[model samples]
Target: MIVSNVSLSGCAGANSALCAAVGDGHQGGGSYRSTLSPTGNLVVAVCLGFIGTFGLLNNLLVLILFCRYKMLRSPINLLLINISISDLLVCVLGTPFSFAASTQGRWLIGEGGCMWYGFANSLFGIVSLISLAVLSYERYSTMVVPTEADASNYRRISQGILLSWLYSLAWTLPPLFGWSKYGPEGPGTTCSVDWTAKTANSISYIICLFLFCLITPFLVIVFCYGKLLCAIRQRKYRKFLAALQYVFGLTE
Candidate 1:
């Protein structure tokens, strides 16, 4: 069946699926298939519907603010705006259809749509993750290193943002080239990587994607925040010592 959707760049011609049940709490998944009955599905639909609507409005407003106000156009704000863009994509593209499918207890977007929705869902999710890691590293660098604190690193940050999208494209595009594949999963209510397929190509893609995409970004986030925490502790210790020195000097 033909699926109608606004064309986007990554994996437009590819078939795919959304996050598995294990990944995003979506109905279709590995061992965690959707067990929701009609009534339960209705409840889920209500919750997801509300979240999608509210998030879309909020993220869209932030994006507009960034564009409307020059003062808001800082380097860090650029990263944040990108984050908002990714979230808004999820809201507008992934949420409604998935929720509707859940409610109906089947995939409604047709075969091609299953691929489109899944492709979109994966793309947005990776963008969000990488943006967050980049945002945290940016914050840490600005706070810890005084010299590189200004928007002088704007070029680098922009490059990083570009790289984030590129990285997402790198992983998502493989299925189209036959390195891996995407299809319906978990009770046929959702779509995602065919995790059940244990072909060598699929396994390799999964391993590489997990390492470069998931694990790498996660480590960057943790390392940046970890350093930031130590810096905070040291700053507090110095302040405490300075206060004691001032009091002792007065007594002397």
Candidate 2:
């Protein structure tokens, strides 16, 4: 958990008291001292290890299934593959570093690693979210306009896959350019977008990230799924009405 009292800026290594109070002398910079005791850190490490292991295995299985089974390579399934790829990337590139940091009770990697971690995770995460949103829309489209869901639909799915990555790239790149910054977050073991920074730059980026990357995709998913449910209900209702009419006509 991130404590409000912790500063975004870390003290230099030369300052003994400052360094001790903050946390460890990470090559990247200093970070907040974790409120969690050694036991808590150990628990975190264990959890991360478990999650990382399973995540790697599961996502790898998904990729293998997709590749091995040509029948599973439908347009809609492409989105699933995209999601698995992003998740697998997160497991490979992001999870192990945080796991290591948790084990050491601090971010062992330098500042560059922290920034890279924050960026990579953010990129993969946003891609997954956007891909989900696109998948929802694709389902809705397939139902509402079955004619368009033909072999030609692969182009649309391909575009969606490409756009998800592009959209994620657009959002995650801002921090590297100075719109916001990435740094050590909760417990000083994991790095992420600097949620603690109160500056206009940081706050603005956070707001945009929440609005576009999170809220927009969420709304898309809800709208698509809601329409799908309505369509299904309507189709069922029509079938029921048809059956009733047929029975009445026969009785008459």
Candidate 3:
């Protein structure tokens, strides 16, 4: 839960804070970099720093456990490890710069760094999503189809993790190649693919990214988890019925 809160809050709040800062600056006009006095910016930096530190420590501990224990080396654990990698990257690569930018009241990384940061942020976010969906599917398979055949699928799951990273990378690069462009996102606190742009290419990229990267994995995780819960209940109910029959001497 700590891991989830820290990772998700950092990811969501980082972006949302930019939008919030923008709104604060322009009073609904949505201008950039005019919001937040120096003190406000410092407060934001302090908050982000705390969030990033907590998340980084938790994820690092998990990684340390994974590396330290041979028993922790399994397909499901690998999926979790991959997820941790993404969150850890978010903590290390994304967080401090956000703190610096927030406190400094503008992007200090220049244009190219801004683009890289945007791409990296998008990449890490997508990787985390894909990792979660894959983990959900693994859990579903384990619960409903715990067979030798399913056990053999471990290699494929690991391969899927690798593929997901590549998939995330592929989508993040389109902006660099001009499908859309990375620009100051909301109050200039961070850089990302300019979602508010009115260009056709920008709209197309946004739609595709939403559908493929975000929506697909989200639906997969939700569906798989729901199915998993139902399966467990069904299994337990069957066991309950069997116990009742055995006690009542009603053999079939």
Candidate 4:
């Protein structure tokens, strides 16, 4: 009789389960397991705090250098300032929440917060890439065709900066418009773009990677470096020959 009673109780417990069994006191399914330990959490928090602080300081320094020193304000420096601002935004907005999400073991920020986080992160990342491409082109032009370089004035540079912002906006707006989905991870509950989802929008991210991050930038960098290298080699050949002459004379 005791054996039968035990079997019945076991069946009931397995079938009904407890509230703990159902959701683990969190919104998502699966057990709530923290990816970070106490020490890890503290370390991450401190690191992110440092990043945020440094980003603020770096942006302020750039601003001060540009404003106080007239010579520091150039088209290239302006591009650098914009990149610094993007980094500042990332450090200020993304890193702290990432630290918290690591500790809390779940996303307490909700759906709206998830969208905002993803948008800001994506926007900044795209902007940084575009700025790198622009800088590379500018350098290439400056080195290869000095005459053409003179045309890269503040007006043209400003237009380039505006175009980068618009490109970032194009990538980031999809989530807001319902074309793409942004939310916290299930099981782990960390906020990020849902790249692995079986959706058309998810595929758009892969396309974005190829177009913006890989192919476009690869072509830009390769083209710029190729031209720059040829120019440098041409200009330095005589100097290199003179150095070789001195070395051979000393050997003799």
Candidate 5:
């Protein structure tokens, strides 16, 4: 009887442990299922598809305009090319990840994916802004001093493009190298540099906007307009004086 009771007790204890293990597994499975549902997955897939499609179309249009038209092949158009390329990257690389995040409300791509997305997005943003600045400067130069504008060389344009790419890479590479880092908010959601984490990301974006969009472009436009006004005034004065000379000669 004693031996039989001991065996029964042991069996009961084993059963209890098994039950507890099963219970814990059930809870874990439930939590995971709730976190990643089929609906969420579908949403993510759709978002990525749409973003990719849009990017493809936009980039193709830009490429067509630049390639097919000789009239559009100028310094200003070169800057547009850079902008279109950057926008293409943003649509192809950055937006798909963003769509995943938006649909799933989490990051599905993991740490490596997050870093890649952040880097591409940041790089393209910088390129777009720099291209805008270059375009503005080119327009201003063209208007302000048309003669001097003819002096822009291939070397200068190439240097500007290189510098813009380098500037973009500088902002993007740090996060990849761990000097900074970005991660998904969750399973299907990714984010850029943690702007809310008291990092310099927000500040850098603000400074870039101020410098390229507000300060530099504004100054260029103003200077260009001033030069235009002076030119117009001089032209009018010369024409008026010529007319007066003709009138006096006819009268005499």
Candidate 6:
């Protein structure tokens, strides 16, 4: 159903599911509105509820485990805790409104709420992705160097975590400043970076976000893990060769 205040003229003749022109009271320009049926909205609400609940509990468990166990507080594992924190924030700050909107079959909050949801989710999600990349690199470093110094390198770990958050924040803020925008996304239940806007600024922001925030982190994770696998295989191979040589020498 269209927002009560939103005019039918703007979204007229457009597919309800795909329409993004529904104007809200707060946003004189327009915002997205879901035209989904009641059953569909119920399904969406149920799914969001499940995901939000499960994610919140799971991440909270991770944080609790890390905090309770001193051995789990290693410089490397701190990255995992960072990821958990970001996930937990997403569940807390982002999921509830979406869940509420889904239950109501439209965005319950106004434009300001939409923008806040979009920015908050994007920031936290990007933080989680960057943290994963950093964690992979940390693992690769441990495997490759295996140094006592690196194992206890709390300073390095802190720097990595700080960089992950700062880098994610840097990218997510541009939308707020009008580099692109943050608005309602699919089904109008959630909000995110505006992907449909074709303006130069919006297009540029999307391209940069895709490359730097997403692609860069993905490539880092792949490269680090690839090198790690190679190192492990080589170590195993050497161990096998040593075992074979010992067996032959004993036989001789």
* RMSD each, Å: 8.5, 4.7, 9.2, 9.1, 13.3, 3.5
Candidate 2 lDDT by residue in tens digits, 17-102: 23432444432244434446799989999999999999999999999999999889888999999999999999999999988877
Regions of candidate 5 where Cα sits further than 4 Å from its true position: 1-52, 147-152, 185-188, 199-252
CA lDDT, every prediction? Answer: 0.75, 0.83, 0.79, 0.66, 0.60, 0.83
Candidate 4 Cα misplacement greater than 4 A, ranges: 1-34, 147-152, 185-190, 241-252
Candidate 3 per-residue lDDT, tens place, 1-252, comes to: 001123332435445544443343334232235256888788889998998999899999999999999888777888888888999999999888878888878666655666778889999999998889888988898888675534667787778799879999999989988898776675577778888767798999999999999899999999999999999899899999999999999978
Could you give candidate 4's per-residue lDDT for residues 85-196 as a string of tens digits?
A: 7887887888777667656654456546666777888888788878878878878877765653234577777887887889878877776766656654433334456654
TM-score of candidate 3 against the unseen true structure: 0.83
Backbone N/Cα/C clashes per model? 8, 2, 1, 0, 8, 0
Q: Candidate 1: deviation at residue 182, Å? A: 1.3
Q: In terms of TM-score, which candidate is strongest? A: 6
- Worst lDDT run of 10 residues, candidate 3, spans 1-10
TM per prediction: 0.80, 0.88, 0.83, 0.75, 0.61, 0.89
Location of the lowest summed lDDT over 10 successive residues in candidate 6: 21-30
Superposed by TM-score, candidate 2 places the C-alpha of residue 4 at a distance from the truth, in angstroms, of: 20
Better of 1 and 5 by lDDT: 1
In candidate 5, what are the lDDT values of residues 74-93, reduced to their tens digit? 76677778888888888877
Better of 1 and 3 by lDDT: 3
Q: Candidate 5: how many backbone clashes?
A: 8
Q: What is candidate 1's CA lDDT for residue 90?
A: 91
Against the hidden true structure, what lDDT does model 1 obtain? 0.75
TM-score (C-alpha, index-matched) for candidate 2 = 0.88
What candidate 2 gets wrong by more than 4 Å, as runs, is 1-34, 148-151, 250-252
**Candidate 1 Cα outliers beyond 4 Å, as residue runs:** 1-36, 147-151, 250-252
Ranked by lDDT, top first: 2, 6, 3, 1, 4, 5
